[model samples]
Target: MQNSFVKVPLWLFERVVGFLLALPIPIYSSAVYGLVTNMRGLPHMLGMYIRGLYYRQKLGLMEPNVFIDQGVFFAYPQGVELKEFSYIDKNVLVMSKTAKVGRRVHIAPRVFISGGGDFEIENYACIATNSNIITSTEVLKDGARCSGPMVSADQRRVFRGKVLIKKDAFIGANATLLPGVTIETGAVVGAGVTAAKSTEPWGVYVGERAQRVGTRDSVLCPDN
Candidate 1:
């Protein structure tokens, strides 16, 4: 009876703490650290609940059922769309805008997605661990110097484009999908590959510049 009594206040205390702490979380990142990342380590499912509350308040409550594991950082939550049954695993850094993540999408741990707010992961698409999807990169001209992030856009050459991963496409581990690249439906981008262009439907790409290795039969694919 004494242990039960002790558990009640502990639970209530965490609830109150979560509620109060979430009020200070804004819609964007902070200079000192990440506001979303600061919301980490809240003790399991309660942490997901509190993180959901923060996102719901800041990002208009995108989805109630999406599971965002601890240690994940969101640089811009205002531009993200979290659909149902989506699982964003641990330590994933989402520093992109216009991140349209469709239903049942699985973004694995340590996946870094950054861009010009024009990236889309359609329904049932799975991005494996340690993959990078970047949309905007600084281009170096012969006479111009490479500058840092704090520098103004006019001072540097920047290239921004759209990245789209269509329905049922699978991105293998440690892959890098650059600007203007589209992983078409049912295509598989193999591990350690870097792509700079769009892929064909049911195509298997395996090299640095997306060299076509083989093709998968589209008839055997499944959709949930």
Candidate 2:
């Protein structure tokens, strides 16, 4: 099937809208942030839609049904994609261009996802509040290097890889998913865990360096 959305490049926006637009973007974002942070209920929902409309026009691809809550900041939204029915909660910072959120996905408040590589959250996936997902990291190759748009070009070398969260996966609160890791379908990543490796489908993982404690089916049918 043909892709339904467009991924606008950062350069393209600059070229089309000119550099003047850059100066006011942060200010506009801040105003929206403030507005969203202060309001709640119907007012907050209205603000979300308003901001979402502006973002969809300025950024690359944001589907019509997507809901972007207040205080959500994106450094480079050009490469981002928010599929249908997905909602981003408050105070989320997405600093990467390669972030893709799938349908019906719920990203709770204070979630931070960053890096230059692909960060994909599949349909029906939920990432709890304060979760950190990194798909890009700085390494000392020729010297200390950083990978991202905001960093100086020569100062740091940034390495990027794909971080995949498959369908039906549940990443608990404050969990950290590192670069190149995959949380497979129906997998449960326990709270406060740091996942450094790929997980098995339907597995239940916990701890700092997450280890499989059980399967999802076992959790659902404990008597079996």
lDDT of 1 by residue, 200-219 (tens): 99999997777998998875
Q: Candidate 2, 106: how far from true, in Å?
A: 0.3
Per-model TM-score, in order, reads 0.79, 0.75
53 in model 1: Cα distance from truth in Å? 2.3
Model 1 Cα displacement at 8 (Å)? 21
Give the Å error, residue 123, model 1.
Answer: 0.5
Off by over 4 Å in 2: 1-43, 140-157, 218-224
Report model 2's TM-score to 2 decimal places: 0.75
Candidate 1: worst-modelled 10 consecutive residues by lDDT? 27-36
Q: What does candidate 2's lDDT look like per residue over 141-204, in tens digits?
A: 7766455557787787777889999988999999999888999998999999999899999999
Clashes of 2: 4
